[model samples]
Target: MNKLLVLICSGALLSACAGTNIVSLESSVKQLKDLRDHDRDGVIEAREKCDNTVLGASIDNYGCGTRKTLIEPLKVDVKFAHNSYEIPSSAYSQIQRLADFLNKNAELQVLIEGHTSKVGSVELNQRLSKNRAKAVENVLVENFNIATERVSSVGYGFERLADPADTEVAHSTNRRIMAELSHTVSVDDMIWTIYTVDQTQ
Candidate 1:
């Protein structure tokens, strides 16, 4: 009889322990679920220092939006000789400055605009302008290691002249290559915006 009584008490203790363990396990699971990312900002609730972040905003590891400055309007003017598309060695420094700027801002892209004087035929000027733009683009891509996809070239020909006067100085000024850089940057406490303008225009 005593043996049977002891066995009944042991069984009860085992059942009670099992019930306690099940409840504890459920509580632990609930706590884990609660610790999951509630805001869905790629950060978990346990480690997230910032809460309620704006959707699609660029963020750091701490779940905080990163600060960024708008890139200023950049214009690089590279002069070309009359009826020539060759980039002069003197222009290398000017082109290098543009390349340095691009290397610093990896997200920015540049547009090379080529222009010509009215001294040549319309078709020839157009082709010459295109070649001039391409020449600058090649130096940026090949010599400076800038990505080709980030640089683009376009020819304006004599359609867009810096000086309309029919003088030697005006013609020299008109025959030029212009580089325009632009990109949108993410700023903290504000929406992503693009603030760069074509200063050459």
Candidate 2:
């Protein structure tokens, strides 16, 4: 009776260990210890992504997932008044489109910049520039439901010129808003699922 009970307990423990999947970093560390204790740096270690899967995704050595590339920023020229931060009615639909695009790209991040013409005091121009950026930020936040943390606003204050001319066309064109997607991607955010069942054991 004692022998039989011991056998049953051992079987249950084995099954529990076999079915474990470590998804977190700490959990993964323990999982790795349980899996590759005998040969720490062996070929099996290379194949551990299959042994303890976290995201159920295609993974590399570092355990990342499949990547979805987005054409971030979806930029358009948003123009405002010379000294005003108010978004004009004529540009409403255009900004709306950008907001709509931002909604669709939750995984992405952005930087919204406001520009102005070279016809104002530097201090006032800076203020106006910041306000213009804020104006775009408000629209994106209010209408699109995009998280404010995911968006950052800046004011160029006529520092960056598109046309670099004194003409109305140049000034009008410079008075614009631009949003760009973050250039960096988080390497740790991906879910990598590896299928090395044959190699793991």
Candidate 3:
């Protein structure tokens, strides 16, 4: 009777060991499957902050942005007074944001082109526009500490205007300084990649 009891106990122990082995094997299999998925996807699991990423695209350099390409330069328009070179506080926020971008893209350069309305004479308008552009450039270099070498100022002198009208609203569009980025950006280097993605926006 004692031998029979001992044999039954041994049988129960064998069953438990077999069950544990099966569970361990299952867990290992699951881990392998997860690894396989990560490898097969080929999509980068992590994203970089500086990257202008597109749908299902991964950044090339970790912090510098995506490995893809840009189509056009990022243009920053700095509007101004009719004939004044003063930097307005209202436009400061946009400048501040631009300063941040400039800091990130150290390799980048900009040409700050100034414009004016037809209110002034050709010579006076050209001078005023140049000064206005220089004024903004001064702030960007002095306050933002952007490399002076990376920036150049030009005066179109009423040659280019979104609106060339006699009205104040139209003239306002002409009185502006615009920054054209030296480098082009890929479709991915943008935050909202889609055109009017946010309906409410």
Instruction: Please report, as a residue range, the 10-residue window in candidate 1 with the lowest summed lDDT.
Output: 21-30
Candidate 1 lDDT, 70-171, residue by residue in tens = 756667898889899999899999899899989988888888999999997999999999999999999999999999998999999999999999999999
Q: Which model, 1 or 2, shows the larger lDDT?
A: 1
What does candidate 2's lDDT look like per residue over 44-122, in tens digits?
4545543443343445564434454543345667888777888888987877777676666666666789898988798
Give the candidate number with the greatest lDDT.
1
lDDT of each residue in 1-201, candidate 3, tens digit only: 112212223354465433232211122222322222232223333533343334444444433434447554466777777678787789888777677778877877777888888887899989988998898788889988988997778888988877967899988888888886545554543334465467437
lDDT of each: 0.82, 0.68, 0.68
lDDT of 1: 0.82
Over 4 Å off in model 1, which ranges? 1-71, 182-201
Model 1, residue 30: distance off in Å is 39
Candidate 3 residues lying further than 4 Å off, grouped into runs, are 1-73, 182-201
Model 3 Cα shift for residue 105 (angstroms): 1.5
TM-score of each: 0.57, 0.53, 0.58
Q: Tell me, what's the RMSD of every candidate? A: 11.9, 16.8, 10.4
